[model samples]
Target: SRPWRRRLWDAVQAAVLDPTNGLPKELRAQIAGVAMAVMRECAAEQPDLEFIAEMNDHFAAALWR
Candidate 1:
């Protein structure tokens, strides 16, 4: 499970790495949708506050930019 989570993170990272793909309007919306769902689920678990904060910040920065 951890490994798959890591893989998913990796894929997300890769997907956003390229300015071309990352800058596309449609792709940005899709990424925001997926990240929002993930962040909500992650926060629902009442995880370590620091980790949750970090994850939220990460996703927010990506989606907002």
Candidate 2:
């Protein structure tokens, strides 16, 4: 289950890093807004501190790259 989650996360990260260039601007913004909302909800649920920290680190690293 953990491995599956990791794979899913990797796939999402890849998609975020390399989004479809052909997507309309409005559609892209809508997608990103929804994604952020979902992430915020997950954060609010407070599942695991370590997992949150790891995800934060991953996003931080990706942003820097």
Candidate 3:
């Protein structure tokens, strides 16, 4: 398993948590929820590539909004 990936997740979670980061709480929550879901699928014994890709697309679209 790639431990650094988890560290990346930790960083995302931390950003959502830190109010000093300046992002609105609601937007942070929305993005973070998808990130956490991606982490869960990645941690699974058989990660779903399709789901991960779907989540990635969703994240990209979210960024544009």
**Candidate 3 residues 1-65, lDDT tens each?**
64554565667778887878788889889868877887887788888878877866765686699
Candidates 1 and 3 compared by lDDT, better number: 3
Worst 10 contiguous positions by lDDT, candidate 2: 1-10
Candidate 3 — worst ten consecutive residues by lDDT sum?
1-10
- Which one wins by TM-score: 1 or 2? 2
**Candidates sorted by TM-score, best first:** 3, 2, 1
Please give, for residues 1-65, the per-residue lDDT of candidate 2 as tens digits.
Answer: 23433443444544654556565767556545544544554545444546545766765686699
Off by over 4 Å in 1: 1-22, 46-65
| CA lDDT, every model vs. true structure | 0.57, 0.53, 0.75
Cα RMSDs of all predictions?
9.3, 11.0, 2.6
- True lDDT of residue 30, candidate 3: 81
Q: Please, what is the TM-score per model? A: 0.36, 0.42, 0.65
Question: Best-fitting candidate, measured by lDDT?
Answer: 3
Candidate 1 yields a Cα-based lDDT of: 0.57
Q: Per model, state how many residue pairs clash.
A: 0, 0, 0
Q: List the residue pairs that clash in candidate 3.
A: none
Models ranked on lDDT: 3, 1, 2
